[model samples]
Target: MTAVSTEIPQRRELVTELPGPRSRELAERRSAAVAAGVGSVMPVYVARAGGGIVEDVDGNRLIDLGSGIAVTSVGSAAPRVVEGVRQQVGESTHTCFMVTPYEGYVDVCEKLAEVTPGDHAKKSALFNSGAEAVENAVKIARYATGRQAVVAVDHAYHGRTNLTMALTAKAMPYKKGFGPFASDVYRVPTSYPFRDPEGMTGEQAAQRAILAADKAIGADQIAAVIIEPIQGEGGFIVPAPGFLSALAAWCKDNGIVFIADEVQSGFCRTGAWFASDHEDVVPDLVTTAKGIAGGLPLAAVTGRAELMDAVHGGGLGGTYGGNPVACAAALGAIETMEAEDLAGRAREIETIIGDRLRELQATNPAIGDVRGRGAMMAVEVVKPGTKEPDAELTAAAAKRCHEQGVIALTCGTYGNVLRLLPPLVISDDLLREGLDVLADALSPKG
Candidate 1:
């Protein structure tokens, strides 16, 4: 198989309209065949993607700012990932790790142990998606601690499964109709500096959450405290300094397993191997996905060997978990990250995007806040002179970006935050152009 090229021209060029003719046709077909439950942010139908551009069927090349929701951090069609998957496909697709294991799977686990935030001997179990990895983390925590209750924070989004829905705080689309969620899940306050009481330090916020958890579900009864180091779907909310470390210390004192949901923030997406590394906070368990396997589906839960090995031999794993192809892709992706120094690249991205957004915030009252680390930056939109969310304005800005051939995504519990997750491989020129589009989109119109 020929290697997928990473040499696509690093520029955005729109021909015809936004959706164009071919994409519109595909949209019609999708409306009929695809389930209505699945949603899409842009109308364009992609034909090929590389570096920073996603080419559509109608021959329009759009600048990719969303990175497929932070999944393609190593860049779409990364050379190493393409080569690895090509070779793996020729050899074998699946023997089912549960049935007949492969070296690729073992190699991925070893890599996970090395990169995850901790020096302790660690082991890992692979899964198919972020939600699956999170679910398995909770299982391991509960089993090891002999406890039942799990604690989640406000605005947190774990996943879509019944159990994860219970963990997620959003109710509209993710949890509204889906009732009767998994039991033993509790919610607490999180340190959102933008909305917190004026001058509330991270330690104070941690204490408030601790008090709430203690009052609601005694710490001794809690199995695990799972959180996204820098929440992904929850508007890229980065907690105040010292918040995570305080929580980790509290969990240690309480015998509760601390799981960092780095599904979105891992694999150098946040200027570091893991966001937890920024604060020197080591979680008992770390769940990873998104950028783990390039564009392929692969997730993992890596943690202390003792905690991971607590379960029975066959207790962990799924039929397609750690499929050889995905494992190969992960190895290749990790290799690319290390060889390319994507972590440093992410920090550079943070400098570029963060400076631009902060400048925008200075003049635009609608931009309530500019926050997040590395390439996972966001702008929270709000009514001028007030903290109240402005979902309408957020939607309008995102729509404008789409019409201008830029892919942007919106998130947050209130749906009023515009998030940017560009691939680490994106060119400086493309990044600036995409930012220019966003700036124009957010600008007030007559």
Candidate 2:
């Protein structure tokens, strides 16, 4: 999208067997050097990546449908991001925004204000990850509203930190051993149209959640109601239309801050600047990370000026919160998204994924659902004749794809959904080929 064609060929090419000799050696080294707690879905050491291809140490060219978990929407080596970061690092890498204020930090915040929904005057504070942003957002909400409780929806994935782990839904991998989490964090039901009862409308789903939240944590005690408009890491579930707006309205009337965790759904990945734009919902605060800075480690909590400014001076400063290099990368990433209108490209991706996935669904009953927006589509793999999850089948299919040099990622509370997050700049030929490979992987003889 930014005249940033990949140096590597944009195709899945298997030069050797899966986990080729070089990759196998690297895995062995990693096993020795890295902590066992860190898990990697694919162990092939990447040599370079750009556009839609990742070339590994084995020279195996893998078509990246996952986009490094949706962090490289503008391509891994987007020209703007690289150039911006290179210039910033040459000048100065880290002065620490709090110690010596720099313009890059303010520039990134300005870009956030311009892109995020709402014309209202907004301010932002930068952080290092989505979890940090969420933690800080909660802190601000509590300080501003004088409340202590935070409500999040089921199947949500806020982060891996102590506070975020409590906010997340899945427990096995994220919150299993970590106990004695932060207090006053509540979980409420959310709309999952595919799994909800028959004939339930958006308003009904909203009411059910609202009532549940009230019963669990009184509205007066609630500091914020946080949710992912398009629930990422929770099956890529797109909630029923009007469900978000209804919840936002409820938050407004109850004086609770509405927080949209747009970590994976923001920055033009969902056919809009943010998924909330699809519903025209203006969240009181938005948490963004993944795609915001291309591939840099950057995140932000942007919201109305009054709420953002409520925190005491020195209450939110961090050592590396808004590193100048990361801020520059964010600006460059934002520039590329704006100049190319990646949101429009995302819509094109949706059409491709929707048409192919739906066609496959019509023939293969195992795909119980194909739902998502733009390049963020996914299929809930289930038993052939029912809605029961088939995590075994899903994992097998992913392994088969990985074996054939196609990089795909699986997610969901049940680990049964295969999520596709190809870069918005991917060529049509590559996307089609990638889908064809996936279709083959799902077949019996593939």
Candidate 3:
């Protein structure tokens, strides 16, 4: 129901080769000014973006499939967000919530309480990024529960900061030589239906995860059990049904906080207000960012009022945790979501994407899996007729996409999953064209 703004032409128009002269110049400048570790999938610098297309410095208008890693679900430069930010910036950019405080922060927290899963009383703490929100959620859990051990799932990605790095599962890139990470963080297996032994049921997968955690680290000692309802960086791995409910029940029984890291799957991107809504799983705490504030940086951790209140006064918050501009943008973003019924739009997009990808799977043996919900969908690339990951092919296919003016992103621990996260306001024609271009990139001739 969210309307695509008419200001942006909802079509793909390529006027130059990918990474033309202007982009090449910017890349050269970036190499000298930016850190080598700061990597980007597509180095073509964005000059403008709206609807489903991003115009690069080289004037290459490519179909946007990655919504700035899912931050612009309301669309980049969403009218409400732009105007809200403009007004807030004029009034005051930062009063530092800890110092003078502000109404914007309170308003955002109220919206979060109203929208996040469950009908119980809730409280929230704001932060500048998803990582900060996660870090603080962990802090709140440990402080409230008086437990030190944290349990995260296999293939989980929390964040890059030292504490979150410990919670994270990947070694290369995110972990590498960064450790020795913080202590008492445990990793347990989760239901990844695509890779699990054949015919495993949701109940069975949940029990396996439960047993893994109980045996490795006594659940009584755990402060929190955090997971992504639909794992994002881990290839959009949707856990089997009942998996989340089982975890929630176990946490409640053990006095352990259940946290859902909804950084990528939240804010109506997953055909629901939150992915947890799909499973009727009410998390004790939910960490959100990404699409929460259109393109402005804002994140929050909303949890049960009792647990949040358990923390000492001034236990949470940072200088720019809830910058007025970001808060204003979040307000406008939430208003847009509710007014437009974006959850419905996400479901509509899911049908189109799922059907098209399934059709591709019918012919392309390299497509091992097509999974995910709503706008948060992805396809796994495997060796022809085999489940073994074909990361090389995935990389090559993505390169092919880039050369042809399509912004396709490749993710997954195995580096073989092609993720699609188009803006919610993207036109149906634009989505079809993006899919067609993707089909061409994956075609045998390509």
Candidate 4:
């Protein structure tokens, strides 16, 4: 047996079947204990994971393309992260960063300030989930700008809280029964190039959204305008080139705090530290969580110091906002990102996946569009020669890929978009293998 350390295991092994019998029994028990609303794409229970691979309880080893929904960018069981967590846990688990501050928490904040995009003086506040980070960004914006109304893009996925749910555009499961959402939240059109009128430029789409915001809410009353550089659950939708910068300029001119919800696209998932880098549109505030801590639960809102400090003392934070162990994990994750050049790796994956996806689009007439930035990408499914969504076929393709041992996710308002967010550290060969599986799954017969 290999000695455990803060490093990747030297070997990849799968000894049991996928979701071995034991895992199935445990899953049944879990289903009984939890609400049915919480879903699982693959029922295989994880026994252990290292690098870009996850070993199921049943002994089947599978490449992890999901990265725990983009949370484990450095790869599962990263050595530094594991070591840091071990040390932190051995010292102390929780004191609530608010009650008694610790070095790990402070260190994370320091790192966030130094690394987050803008050259301006920045500050950061930690949270446990992307939703909390987003909610806190809104709170800070409202507090800073002294405005009540907030604007968000169509098909944005903010969070589950009342205010965030209001910011979010999807209704089916997120907003379905959760009635009485927060008010003063308005939705504006996003620069969805695939669906835009032919010949429309990115600037045109931004103007359309700005016009809607101006007329509907009056840019003056809007405290903040939040958008994901690349819409995540809304289907890895990458906006046009000039769209984000135009919107950012508008927000700046109107004194509205611009927020980039990089929850799913940050931490080098899209070839850069943040997807915002793709457009060089620095926002007043940036929310991040998914890949920040190498699978440990950690999220943050980094922004201009003045705005972040606008909140009164004790106005922000949580019991487990910046847990010491999580902070340690974040430190390790950041180090791995810088040292191993995972950002470059993400770009490489993009080239490989992009080329393959374009080829698939050419072969599969049902694929209406293939779009995304860096490793964060998607293929939109539609009826051949028409825009009608083919969610059924999308679901089937995902199921087939799963049967072939590849885990992929489907998104989009109509659930017709297949998104790819494999860990940045995923080997090119493994990634290509997964894409081959996807291609076969998409074929007329598999």
TM-score of each: 0.98, 0.99, 0.98, 0.96
Distance from true location, Cα of 22 in model 1, Å = 0.6
lDDT string, candidate 2, 366-441, tens digits: 8999999999999999998899999998999898888878899999999999999999898888888889989887
Error of 4 at 36 (Å): 1.9
Consecutive 10-residue window with the lowest summed lDDT within model 2: 1-10
Q: List all candidate RMSDs to the true structure.
A: 2.2, 1.0, 1.0, 2.6
Better of 1 and 3 by lDDT: 1
Residue 152 displacement in candidate 1 (angstroms): 0.3
In TM-score terms, candidate 3 sits at 0.98
lDDT of each: 0.94, 0.92, 0.91, 0.87
Model 3, position 388, has a per-residue lDDT of: 98
Write one digit per residue (lDDT tens) for candidate 3, span 39-125. 899878988998888988877788899999999999999888999999998999888999998999999999999999999999999
Q: For candidate 4, lDDT tens digit of each residue in 91-128?
A: 99999888888999889999998878889999999999
Q: What is the C-alpha lDDT profile of model 1 across 1-446, one tens digit per residue? A: 01224767777888889889999999999999999999899888999999889999988999999999999998999999999999999999999999988899999999999999889999999999999999999999999999999999999999999999999999989999988999999999999999999999999999999999999999999999999999988899999999999999999999999999999999999999999999999999999999999999999999999999999889999999999999999999999999889999999999999999999999888999999998999999999999999999999999999998899999999999999999998888889999999999999970
Candidate 3 residue spans exceeding 4 A from truth: none
Off by over 4 Å in 2: 1-4
Q: lDDT for model 1, please.
A: 0.94
For model 1, the run of ten residues with the poorest summed lDDT: 1-10
